[model samples]
Target chain A: MHLAVDISLRQGGFTLNASIDCWSSALGVFGPSGSGKSTLIRVIAGLAKPDSGYLELDGDVLFDSENRIWVPPHLRGIGVVFQDARLFPHWSTEKNLRAGMTLETTGMFSFEHIVKLLELQPLLKRSVNDLSGGEKQRVALGRALLAHPRLLLMDEPVSGLDAKLKEQILPFLARVHRELHLPCILVSHDLPDILRLTDRLVLVRDGMVCGQNTLEGLVTQRGAFDMMRRSGLMSFVSLEVDGEPVRAGVRPDEIMLANRPVEGLSARYRKPGVIVRLIDHGPTILCLIDTDEERLMADITPDAVRELGLKEGSPVWCFFKAGAVHSFD
Target chain B: MKSISPAEWTALLLSAKVAFGAVAAVTLPGVLLGWLLARKNFYGKVLVESLVYAPLVMPPVVTGYLLLVLCGRNGPVGGWLGRTFGWQLIFTWQGAALASAVMALPLMVRSVRLAVELVDRRLEEAASVLGYSPWRIFLNITLPLARSGIFAGLLLAFARSLGEFGATITFAGNIQGVTQTLPLAIYSALQMPGGEAAAARLSVLSLLLSLMALGFSEWLARRAKTGRSTHAPCR
Candidate 1:
């Protein structure tokens, strides 16, 4: 099912005036903190009400302030998994899982099925706190799924997880979208999450939709550069090679020394630029390179620096493959 | 030990009856007022809160005197009740129980109010989403979660009623085998010549009963706290 939301809410000095009319199989709300990412989802879920707005889910008008019609969150057929797991402490993992299910919506997604889907069988007897961060998030996902929500809203579902734990849970989340045939709006600030989970991205900035495009298309836009500047980073353009579409993402440590236009064997996306500055960082120096209105951070070892005779104002031909480009928010 | 005399037994039985009756009288209104103060934010919230706590802070005799004026036979409400329902409250066992209920109402309300405030609004929202009506939600979810606090309040109210003195004596008068609750009996025993042993026994009994009630209240609070999950389910 598709969801449509156009809501405006004011909190102190910040005003969130968000309007979205897109329909996607999966939509990702990608933004930095304080960008009203959570507020948008909360408004749609009825957790936080917008002062004046209208919400229609799957062609049903869930809320319209003008009409004074408001459908509460539970009746909206939407499920939300907050960043914090919010598992009931008093309940066992099984009981907490069961809490999301009832007789009216029975058998849509069974308790056993969710337990298996999230690999929750081992955790059934454990208290919510007894489980690790990854386990709690999995249980939270299972609980939301058992409720049989028409559409799911996940707010940074893995923000607290370490890299390894995040890797562990990402596949399960992907499977939920695939197997359940559920439309989802996933909110996060992490680029990897968007790349791994969603095709369509909605970028929010200062409580407004600054841009909306595919992950690939948005990264190519000027706003991407602006966002990168705020992030103290730069973009490495992806190129097409041998009829195979290749994308390149710049890592801060991958650049090597090249004084002249060295004939690279097969590296794609060759860009000629000058080293602008070098900041000493003990064994390595942070080399700032300027290429076509873009600044990239490259960490080169002192040995590589001495061998290449690299210095500020030195012209260099950076050879990197287009396959490394990662299109994420 | 030995069996108590009939006079002492009479006082013990009377106190038990008064405490029970006081609980019955105060529970419904106590709960209502507690919920009102806890959940609502209407005008005069502060004034109502102060008025409810007045008996707790004010001299009990003053509260008893107020009750006497309002619930006495010739008083406006008392006269109306007498005319319509043939109910008379002044200087009777029922009047003593009413006085005790007034003295205990604030304690009952404060505990229940605190519990009601702690009931998560998100859970209530979750209940609504689950197709439960507001009344059903209150009965099933809210009440169960707040039960420990309500029971603590009830026990406190009952204990307060058992030991109620100034209000009961002032409003109902200390009549032998009638409105003479434990405190009133103890007061009377202390005044009578050669009544030290009986007074000491009654004091010990009061102390034991209060200690037991206090212990139970602490247990209930601790149980409620331990039952709390670090991450309670979101609405």
Candidate 2:
């Protein structure tokens, strides 16, 4: 799915100016709170019209100020899973899910399919108000999918959930995008959550798209490195499937950079690779390493970097403990 | 205790018919106007609002006089009715219903507007995003959510219609077995010396009915106001 947004909107006293041209089945929009991330999601969902620009989603003109064209939200066939899980409180879970389905719904994403996919069978007859936070979010996600939308817009879908509930809902989000092949724009302030789904990231700061790149690519930019450090730049890694494929993560702090390979070491991953870039902050330098399989980021002290002579194109081994590779299933 | 005389029973039945007819006539229009007033902002909003509420603040006599001029025989609406349907509204039971509805309209509008405004707007927007048309959302969400408020408003309007007098007296007249509602019957009874016992009985029933209507309406409104389970169990 491709989206082109060159728009400016003034809401109250804040003006949001964003220009993003991205194509990804799972596009992640990451930003801090009050950075207009949700506003961007709303614009894409056609919930809010841009003041003076154009928006084309998958070749459909959603909004074009110059042409006097504006598509209504329901006509856009774009579904939104709001942050607060705005399910109709008076309706049952089954009713809420069916609310998104029209007569045109085909056999692909049928009622039984989504119900089984989201595991909503047991909760179908229950009142929406009676469901737990995680369950409500799952229902909200299923409802949006049942709409059969070309693009799904989720604004802080799991931000309101607690840590345990968030852990419960993330897998459903991943399955929706991966198995169903649903194109979604997931907007959230949490970086790790977005990384868990897709690395194709759009960084929004102060109502503007500060940078747009994959999580690995963004790590190489000096400006992006410092900003990402504030949010803790822990890059996601797709581990090779021995029997079952599992997505793993490596925190920048867990990675140790070495100039020469030592004979004995307990760290599981010790691959000799080339250093692509170096981002120097005040006390430490963030090294971007390109292994044959993936790009890894390791944070080491300036003293270590100076001693090892780690620079662009320098050969080094990125080491991390076996336990440091956190698996997401 | 003596049983109700035929005249008193006729008067009682006519009052019920007029009040029931009045409530029925105003309900649909009242709800529409209430929703419009609560949701829309357009040209001459204040003027439209004031006109809807004018009957509430103005003396009932003035409203009666206006209705009399507009709907009386030889008047535009009365003449059209006479010509089109060969029916007359002046000095009839339907005329009393018209007067009662006019007097009770403001109460209905005010109650329904407040109720519709209290419905969560986000829910409606969510329905819209879920592919519901505005009318369907109103039918499925807004109306059900505002049900208690509307019931309270209807009861209040019914109560107001039950006791309507000045306008009914002016426009429909106090003819026996026709427009002589409970209050009109009581007013007629008080003028005669031997009508004391009958008037006393009818007056007590009227007061009791009014109090009961008001009490039930208040109870329903308070239940909704306290955020209770009336909003629960809506399919």
Top-TM-score structure, candidate number: 2
Question: Candidate 1 at residue B120, lDDT?
Answer: 81
Q: At residue A300, what lDDT does model 1 achieve?
A: 78
User: How far out, in Å, is residue A85 in model 2?
Assistant: 0.5
Once fitted onto the true fold, the runs of candidate 1 whose alpha carbons sit more than 4 angstroms away are A228-329, B1-3, B24-36, B74-94, B115-148, B218-235
| Tens digits of per-residue lDDT for model 1, B138-221 | 665677677778888899899999889999999999998999877888898899998888888777777776787679778877
Q: Could you report the DockQ of all the candidates, in the order they appear?
A: 0.18, 0.46
Fnat of model 2, as a fraction: 0.43
Model 2, residue B124: C-alpha shift (Å) = 1.2
TM-score of predicted chain B, candidate 2: 0.90
Per-residue lDDT tens digits for candidate 2, residues A1-329, read 98999999999988899999998888889888999998898888777888889999889888999999998776888888988998886667888888878788665578898999889999987878889999999999999899888888888999999988998889888888988888988898888788878889899989999999887778767677677777856865665545665667788898888888876889866667899988876677777888887778888898898888878999998777878987777
